[model samples]
Target: MSDQSLLRERWLPGVRELSFGGDYNPEQWPREVWAQDLDLMRRAGVNLVSIGIFSWGLLEPRPGEFDFGWLDEVIEGLHAAGIRVDLGTPTTVPPQWFWQQNPHVRPVMRDGTVLAPGSRGICCPSSPEYAEASLRITTQLAERYGKHPAVALWHVHNEYGAPVSECYCEVSAAAFRAWLQARYGTLDALNTAWGTTFWGQTYGDWSQVGAPAQSASMSNPAHRLDFARFSSDELLGCFTRERDVLHEMSPGVPVTTNFMATNCPSMDLWKWSREVDVVANDHYLTAADPRSQVGLALDADLTRSLADGRPWMLMEHSSSAVNWQPRNLAKRPGELARNSLSHLARGADAILFFQWRASRRGAEKFHSAMLPHAGENSRVFREVTELGATLWSLTDVLSSRVQAPVAILWDWESLWAQDLDWRPSVDLEPRRQVREYYERLWHDKVTVDFAHPTADLSRYAVVLAPASYLLTGEAAANLTAYVEAGGHLVVGPFSGVVDQDDAVHPGGWNGVLRDLLQVSVEEVLPLPENAGVTLTGGTRAGVWAEDLAPQDAETVLEYTDGPAAGRPAVTRRALGGGTATYVSTVLDHHALTAVLDPVLERAGVTIDRDLPWDLEIVSRHGADGSEYVFAINHAGAPVDLPVEGVDLLTGEPCTGSTKIPAGAVRVFRR
Candidate 1:
């Protein structure tokens, strides 16, 4: 066992603390409101909850009937109130008598309609009767809560490719032609990697391959990027077939599922973060983006870089305003402890939420919870009982980690082949160009993570990419062996321009990092809708541009007015002692902080250049050589925060300058 004892037996088994509660339906109130929802979840400092996700029609009310008597009295009253469960597996809402006995296991749209089952991720992840009734209700909830003692953590299916990810059924077109004959083992290599001899749409059997369904015009950007990689590996084979039946009926519990990470752009969370066992997520607050806290610190540093930096799980969020946006905005008083201490300063050793009393009915009765509806005398249960007494005084940040010298690549099949549908700018959004370079390295407090461009970037000292439009030749030789072992890369616009089968890159436009970006692209000029451009150091740029020739690099910004006017709009090259650069357009954020402040001072990196673009900070450390930090502040007044010591949320002390008020959050401990 040791992957640190299976990550503390799947998320602190014998509690190292910090798991706060939420999502506890308690069969939508009744049995004396489950002892006043366990005395308002122990007066709001709840400790892990997520019970029976959307309770499969009151836990099987027919069809092989079963009912765990009100989930064994709400997991024996949340294990007599010391709380802790994260149990779920309600198979993301399946029971309308198993959708009226499998009405073709629902989900079909790619213009083929069908989707009807009353919401909550309606089935068909390549349905074989939804893989035998979602592994028989996940082997009857892992043989009834696999040795339950308030079952510490299983939470199997809740947010898998949300609201149905891909299912243009004919049983998902014969399971996407048996996942394209196990990934192109010939229909002439799936008609030459779906180029299909340019739209005559060559298939010659594999039952005329389908699922990029309903298309009279646009349906073969390599067959819609391999049906978005076979609908994200058939919803990660329905979450590893219920995470391998909750690891053979719960042999050491710890299963996990949740991960709407960049808000569900259909799974492929680096292949579902190697089939779970902790790496949770959920994040909300796009409440009309006034920089939703920089997309909640870029989804908590891409869910703690998909748990490679360990300490994951902020399982869900919203202790205020979140009833499916379009004008639902609340969390204003210290914005839910600065969005739960910005997901516990980017490593999240458990924070949980999505509920824990508040719903008086269904369809997420006004989403935000943590005992709200004026319950524990509300104000979101007094900032969730003061962020649960500041996460039970951070049990020394349980297995602390978050230390990033900057990294960013993040692939999801190069953002599903740069969100396929005629690229070259529909405002070429690769998640808004990696959230505008992670909100300019999170307003320069600079602590990022994200990797996966062929992993190991010898511990990042500057790496960027920004929106890698599918660059694969072994991630361009692991980024030209991380710029020939010196790092500092960058890239940006229409990056390495396509491979890994979306085609293109065969001598021309960044053919796999033209010799680690000595530059090439002689065409792609995008910008139009309300245009923009300027460059030659006056910066400005917009949507895109390219022309760029510089065969030996060094230009670093040129254009000077729209359609590649004077050409090269940013380059660099260097090589052996690290350098690359690139970026052809789309700059703004003070022109990407004046092209990353001299490449972060030629890769020495360290920033905090008198931080306070609404203060943020970060830190973490701890496997003995302690640290902690945090800060937060999200503006409206006071700031300062140079950081020194003590303050674990007001046990004060912190000299070396601290202050931090208006929309507060501190932490410290250094």
Candidate 2:
């Protein structure tokens, strides 16, 4: 299908996310249980099941291993029963034999020490031995099963980022230096890029410039930031090589791997998402903390947006609660359902529960899955079944769904560089400002596509780059072109401070943006914790404010008090057909709208007319150019979104206004 055609599908369309399925281990269960599951699927609408996430031990028990006996039979059984299957590569970790024998699959740290691997993801991307071994094994699997019609999709390396291992080993150190050499070229360039001259630290030779890190040694914030970038690139390299093989071999089947929320630091996601044809990710948050849960949702929307505003899938979610945190907490009754539905509302294509069947024994043995230890009679099972049925019934309506026109850019490097810098104040976090901007934007019924800051901005009418702390020359040029093309731009405070190398650019920080916005920073004001200011009739304040002087820009909002008081807090510059807007202070939800709404409207954009807080709406025109507007309610309370069209899911006649109940969605056609 064409990219535009794929962009128009729904995540759950006709299928229900009965969130009850667990790791389906038909291998462990008898044929009778398989029969029971078939009946169970019919009753609950369990149209899809994920097979073999943490089954490495079973799939590969010995060296040069090959054991798909049980997996093959399990898949055959599911297909025969008419249940779709999402297959796993089972490459989460090498078999003990491979790691033991090759010794090269292990990841290294910055201190140049090698790590022994029995745990998952110990493979080093740069290691020739690892690339050689994995190539043979993965290629073998792809060749065998790439054409299987029974396989809905292949899950590559389940949850690639947990247990946080950074390869600081000698191999990694060598790779890091080489990467640095490529990036900086000389010790003088490296010293300039790292600002090491400040501490009287200058490299004398290539060997003197270690892999900018302190993993097992004294952790340098700046070095850690560089290491994080390198690590993300390394993982991306691994994924790209494997995916190219799959794309060439299994072009018919859609492929995806799950992403953890943005909290993962080992890699930069903006670069990572480019490798996947389809973006897939897992969504979870601490239910006990309201603030935390909300943050996770925003992150998920960003994740879905990474595929250039295309809707994405929720590959894994908790069935009831989880077992891996410092404190294990079960989701409140109905909360899991609520979370799943919210994902659909935000443009998720599928809702997948992590494991189909709970583990009998393992680290995740006690984790919640659809069939509890007692089997299918459990309450979780019933909930799962009901949800599955709900999804199955509405598959056509939800598939091929599309979201809004506005997208947010979430750059991991920008975030890390912002955090690592020795800024004037400790109260401000770059991520905080970005998330707050999104919260308010969502509240306004704006659909956000999250992607690398350098992604094409032309796809969005109004692009938001909240706290783009690290701005590469390439990214700045792209944004410059975007504004010049008449796209509305809203940049948060503290943007354009550093270049791609994590060093301050002498061209007045924001570099090209300073020229585009027609503004230059006189200084960065470090405010006291409670210090704040109001601009444009209301209070607006946050961690720290950028003190800006307009070159040719028009001041929109000004700080209320202090030395920088009465100065401009928000500025706008006209470039080509579009406007470049910069905010000096972070605003609350109410204030953010006051600044952004006008700009979006001036661009002739419409915010989803005052819907409920949890309601998210999106519209799409199919390949035939048939128009569809999706109304999804994510809250427990029923809400009305006034519109005129037929309900695609229910076959109801055109209602003057659509009334969506709690956890329901309405796809309408004119």
Candidate 3:
């Protein structure tokens, strides 16, 4: 089958409209309340709901004992109400009885402190006992509900490797040793790859190799990086075991695990995306930052790209405010619809919340839900119903795909290596640098898709790689070949400095891609926290400055006056049939705009129109050759959008310029 067909089969099968609703915890309330929830769900247009995510204790109550009585009623009630179900495997939160019996299965921190059992995801991924118990529960659930008409998808586990990403116990160490042995057959090969000869830490036997735990000083960087990879793999192993059980018992039912947006540092989602049948993500706004919801859009866009730009599911997001942040603030009048529509505009076929009903008591009692604490009379519920109707009106846009001409490079190894100690500047975080470039493109109204280092670049016009710290030979060659084959490549500062083993290149920094960019770094000048310098074109540079010289490239921007005056801040070179641009410092917003504008123009990237910072536009091409333009206003004031098309929501012709209200969405079909 084709990729589009696979996406529809896994995510959009049997759903004529976009799937809605979220975690519906009927166990949290009495049986009488279930009927009320079904009524409210229908009134709110909720078609699907995720059930039994953390009900392991309630489902099993004792070792080797199971009870499916309550869940049977819950599923039957929902199915009778015409609501499909995403049945969770209930493995994230192991039951209290199992943990009390097998206490060794609990996770141990790097500091050797065992985590308590009060929170979710406290079980160790490497524990065989934990895996056995989890599989037992999974098999029972799948066998009982496999043939049920309500069952649509299998949720393996909730947010794998969140707080319990790494464990320092002996089981984890043994697993790490086994993983390393599988990667490198002999100890000599392992020692060479880890660069253990430098620190006189070479090991003689596999038993001597262990996880990098707390010590008086910093541990080996390569060891830590490998341990991180092992932990993520272990978690994936647990998920796959449960998934296998479900697939054996229930044929033809797609499986998925909800991914937390960009927040999961341990698991490499790029690898995990291939394991599941469909991609689903959970996202919440950074309420403390108070920025526009554009950052949330960034998360959705990255998730969609992870699924190869096919439509995915927005599994969980708060209707208003989340309770976990330092300060939880409610959303304004139209911010809810704006946030939901932004995700759909990118590539989401479903938009759901963290919960359907508010919690009466728990850690997340204050977290907003579709049915707020005030019940149906609340503003949150009003917006929820309105957004449901609006979403239902866009049924024609289902199975559409996003087309992006620009791609951003996201390397998990680079992120892991960049966070290690003894960097040039602490401000040079990989995510921060990538976000800087992404926000610049967002303000320019340029749609972008994220690509891994090894992803095919034949379709993208421009590829921006920021902080390419850990450059493998293969990755370096892949990037160089792209530029040589007529693709515009932009390299950020501090890139190409180190190899995969955390070892610096022999020559100057950025030596690997030096020939491609035609530039060499003489020395790195770390500016003061608040210091900045300007280039000849009035472009500003801050955080870091590199003393660079052009070998075969021409200097595009040079510093005017500073400690490193008359030095090149940005350089450009023309290769085979394309151009390569190298940025030597962290550029401010104006400077980033100044740098990207010409590159985008040269690449023939389309912006649709010059949009204000508060307005955003994203287009989708339908399977039947129709075009959809989703224009959203994130600002608080009215703005005139210089685009016209047929309004799909109202069937009105929008001509010349269209005025968009604050936090409103306009869907145009052209």
User: Ten residues in a row with the worst lDDT in model 3?
Assistant: 3-12
For lDDT, candidate 2 versus 3, the one ahead is: 3
Ranking by lDDT: 3, 1, 2
Q: Give the CA lDDT, 0 to 100, for residue 126 in model 2.
A: 71
Q: Return the lDDT, model 2, position 388.
A: 69
Q: Rate the local accuracy (lDDT) of all candidates.
A: 0.81, 0.70, 0.87
lDDT per residue, candidate 3, 1-670, as tens digits?
A: 9543464355545777888888999999988999999999999889899999999999999988999999999999999999999999999998888878998877889888988898997787899899889989998998899878899888988988776788889998999999999999999999988899877999999999988988778788888888887888888898889987887788778888998858787788899888888899998888876564768878988999888887899999989989988888889998899999999999999888989999999898999999999999899999999888888888888889899999999877788888877788887778988888988788777889998887898799999987788887788788888888888989999998888778887667888888788899888888888889888788788888889978999998998977679988899999887889999888988888788888888889875445678788888998787789988988878888766788888989988888888888999987
Among the numbered candidates, top lDDT falls to 3
Question: Tens digit of lDDT per residue, candidate 1, span 470-494?
Answer: 8889988998889889988888888
Model 2 C-alpha lDDT versus the unseen true structure: 0.70
lDDT of 3: 0.87
Task: Report the C-alpha displacement of residue 139, candidate 1, in angstroms.
Answer: 18
